[model samples]
Target: MDSIINSRNRCIFGCSLSRLLSSLDGVIQNELARREPSLYQWYSSNQNPLVVRTFVNTFENDRRFNSATAICSEGKPMDTSESDLSLLVLGLFCLAAITKLGSAKVSCQQFFSMVPDIIGRFMDMLLEFVPISKAYTLTKDIGLQREFLCNFGPRAAVPKFANDHGLEISFWIDLVQKQLLRALDREKIWSRLTTSETIEVLEKDLAIFGFFIALGRSTQVYLSSKSHTDSNDSINSIVRCDRCEF
Candidate 1:
């Protein structure tokens, strides 16, 4: 009896997760279609496992953008703002994962797991712009403390990117809220709570999801905006760099 009940619970949770993932996939596809037709083209054309792996590696150490800057007429590196660069890289990382993993295969856990890696990679790339003396300070200052990370980390810039493009991401908040409610109901846990208590519980849980959702709402906004003005074509070059070559 216990085994049967556990199995049922797993099935219910899995169904909810699958539904949420499908919704996320749709969001990603529509955004790619509307803003990054070039990236969409790349995503469609690529299918080899090796190529996918290489692209994933690009998420870590890819430096075509760094190289592109050296060739500019000024003969100096392009001065990318920390916020702008982080937004660009974060956008690429999220979109690349979607393309590589396929939307349905990307679990919610996997999606959130990228936050620390993104922050680490962003900080590594950011170090190039700052003095050696400040590197220690930077690490300690921005070190993965939850409050600062959620509010001021690379992912946080995603909200600003969304706002700049006149995009709405409140759908995510609504979807997450519903998912939380459904989970509580499925567990028969809501009976313990009064209406106010339910609201309080949900608000506490949803706060973290909301922070990340703001970041996810429009992950690749920077890529689209940058593609237009960067004559070096940094965005396309990064996406199609030799690292991703077949």
Candidate 2:
């Protein structure tokens, strides 16, 4: 009896798996592309994978924007502001993921088409998890901690970077809120979201921005604090201050 039941289940599983694999084949893909003409081009037209990968790497590492100095018209490296660097990081990471996932490997345009939906889901999750007063309290703690981290740091570099970090944090936070609003375009949608949603979005933004706050500000705080406090416990500390490459 057990063997008969097992054989029946195996047949069912095999058929389902075969169907799933067949669905991803070129015939169905071409049909999908024909139906949604703008979203998917013929996969045969893709650029070489090696070339795309190299271009992506170079684009992400372009140091001219990384530095505070602006690049010159004569091909000299130029100064970059903290805002520029933050923007560079955000753009490279997000767009690179999109290009790398394009039609060759995944349905790139399909994913891009779904970004608004994704943002809406993110807003929903934020509203569910964090309320207004709760968000305010979290933001206040982060703000104070960031301020303290900035003040006690021994070098000017720490303070300057923290100032830049603050600006970028605000930018991304505002960006998420605006994107969420744009996703829900109906007038009725705006009516559904009161100030509570606003506060929820801000708190959610702080949760993400808190990461950068730690990343850009930690070096100075560590160096200053380590000198006075944890000099003996070398194992618990970082040997060098550097940006996480991810």
Candidate 3:
């Protein structure tokens, strides 16, 4: 009976994982269609190249206008406020992922190979619209950015780049700790609550902290690797320069 139950649990877990991956795939596809409608239609319908290129150019122009409007409000309440920053980051990341996944679908390159470059490019573009300091601060306050980095591991592969651009891992971890403590304080206030209520509070708090911890770990790993790579490259460049001079 126990063996049967274990097998059932494994099957259920596998099914859930499959569903999650499928949902992620669907999200990528939908966002790609929205971002590059002409490309989507052309590929889907097997249309002519010249017409498709024109359509694509028009679509790109439209997207630039829309993105600019989203990044900067004209005559309206500026949409680039702190409240919308999280959503903007998520949207930009999603768009970058979609572009990489699209390339992967067409080419033989693995998705992993394209993710870091795509994310880096997206971050660069996004920084132009919103200051990195604001982005980091907002991400630190809420745990969403950490959660995102944890979810997309390869996207977190360039910690030095992020740090160089002003995202401090220590600062983010400290913020997460503060948030966790606040949650604990709230839980303490409800100490007289029922067992289920206590459990719920604890679970929510753990979820938030766990996300930050995972993000911190990933960032640390990426930064260490990046630092090593940069060091080695610099040494090699120096050696080449010395040889040429000699």
Candidate 4:
């Protein structure tokens, strides 16, 4: 039947992914054993093997679309969203690696370097679209940072080698805040943005925000399900004014 054929294809696809992860994990384990014997033991014995199960359980879960929209540069528009999503994914894997591997800058420097840039740039792009001025300013204050991190950040460089090259999180945060104010006050960029422009930008901002929101919630649930405890508020809410237009 048609359904059976589709199911078989899905199974094959999942199996391929599992095999790939298994192969990569094996390589990782071998390297860890040589470089970090103690870590290798924990990875092999304590942690469960990374086996992927099914991918599409529902019709909605099916990923059949060939192409999708991507946010491009406002000045130089591109057909696709480009490298941002890839960078974001790599960044997240690093964070997960840190959580699982029990190491900070030394162990997860790649993640630390990359995640900040992604957050900084994405947040910067997102604030431009906020429908409310007050909400936009507050979010920009906290979210946009890491001007240098986007440039001088160690690209795939090991922590052992490139530990000194990356920017401190606090430093980038301070730098971004200062930059935001200057661009707002001195540069006078607000006149360029109108209420209509803000509304137009809202969908893109919400798309990126919603994706992270979902990821955050799912991560929280996964962590909490492992151990019950009160959750810290990772995301702060800024209520948009219904009366005001950006």
Candidate 5:
């Protein structure tokens, strides 16, 4: 009876989520159709809508992300691991958006403007996971450049937008490489990390790194299943690092 109850609960939760996503997607489509018909058309006809759909499905009515963004805006210490992890995922979504939609046939200026500040904060937050070394400045001033389509001739924005995304991808690649190495060396340093202060920091790092590893593998499998052949090599390596850590 207990097992049956649990199964029923899981089914109920799944149905609830499906309904929520359908409702939200409908609302978004209606708004886009009214405000930006071109965008709506493109989005509706997009051959691979999985990425954007996944983004919407994951973020719908998610208050945890809302609270995390508010806290980050205030420069408050986001001490909770959930907030930190949420911010990281948010940053990833932002990157993915730039890569996937930057060169699309419609105006994304309004969308881009709203996210620059958040992306800036996310860049700063990402640096916290990385060690301050001569290789990387503790506070690198990397901003998400918004050269939207309206600012210049049509399609002119793609270069700068791609450059900004390149900066983010480079930073992520470096961080992932370092984390992969650190994760491998963790066993050797287990005894040395016995101190509470060191252990706490290490635990946090491990948690964040583990999130990246899991996300990477999922991304790899997703791209593979989709037959994405022309993906960037660095991004491919980032996703392929699943084997390295596991």
Candidate 6:
């Protein structure tokens, strides 16, 4: 009886996810029809080469870049092993979206503006199953989480936004990383860590390195063209360190 109930529940959950994807597809289709009539016509007729490439790129980034990091963050300090399953569902959804609707034919400015909304929706759906506390733990990695929050958090007109959100996010990430590093060092768990465990740690560290690279790139693109020359030089210096080679 318990097994039957569990199977039924799983079926219901799958149906619900299917419906949600359909709804999102409809929304995107309607939005595109209203916003880009020419592109919508091209997509409807199945005649555009760039449409397929753009769709693939968007889906790939959503899956590889955003979804992977989100999954990793979902797995931190909580019983979130099951949350990893969301990546599969999200990938399927992206595949379906690309197959049906293709990418939005919009300006970069419009696309950038739309991205946060899309990300927020994705995060909301993920949080529905995973819970915020667990996700927060995963996202609070010292290097990436702080930079992410600084870029995205809400702004209050009275007080500065970066100070408010950035500081809190930074503190949490720092606290978690310090605790982890201290535990690892004190326990001398490196000796005990299996090859897989060591690899996981190395991957997390690489994620941090990737976050720094992204930050430098964003700074170079938006701030000063020369900004990344110094940043790359700094990264090269650090990467040359004996301990950093993993």
State which candidate has the highest lDDT. Answer: 5
**In model 3, what lDDT does residue 185 have?**
58
What alpha-carbon RMSD in Å does predicted model 2 have with respect to the real structure? 21.3
Task: Give the distance in Å from residue 47's predicted Cα in candidate 3 to where it truly belongs.
Answer: 2.1
Q: Where is model 5 poorest over a 10-residue stretch in terms of lDDT? A: 141-150
lDDT of 3 by residue, 44-114 (tens): 45544676588546644654335433433446443333323333455444444455456547442343344
List per-prediction Cα lDDT, in the order shown: 0.42, 0.39, 0.45, 0.37, 0.49, 0.44
Clashing pairs in 2: 68-79, 68-80, 69-78, 69-79, 69-80, 70-78, 70-79, 71-78
- In the predicted model 1, the residue pairs found to clash are none
Candidate 6 off by > 4 Å: 1-43, 48-106, 131-246
For candidate 3, what's the RMSD?
20.5
lDDT of 2 by residue, 53-153 (tens): 77656754766334322222356433223323333233323333543465566544444454333322222222223432243333233233232223222
Give per-residue CA lDDT, model 6, range 138-213, as digits (tens).
Answer: 4443123442344334421122325354453334334434444564466444453344357778676566555545
TM-score of 5: 0.25
* Candidate 3 error regions (>4 Å): 1-113, 124-130, 136-246
Name the runs in model 1 displaced over 4 angstroms. Answer: 1-107, 143-246
Candidate that scores best on TM-score: 3
Superior candidate under lDDT, 1 versus 2:
1
The reply for model 2, stretches above 4 Å from the true place, is 1-48, 63-110, 119-246
Q: Rank the candidates by lDDT, best first.
A: 5, 3, 6, 1, 2, 4
**Of models 2 and 3, which has the larger lDDT?**
3
The 10-residue segment with the lowest total lDDT in model 1: 237-246
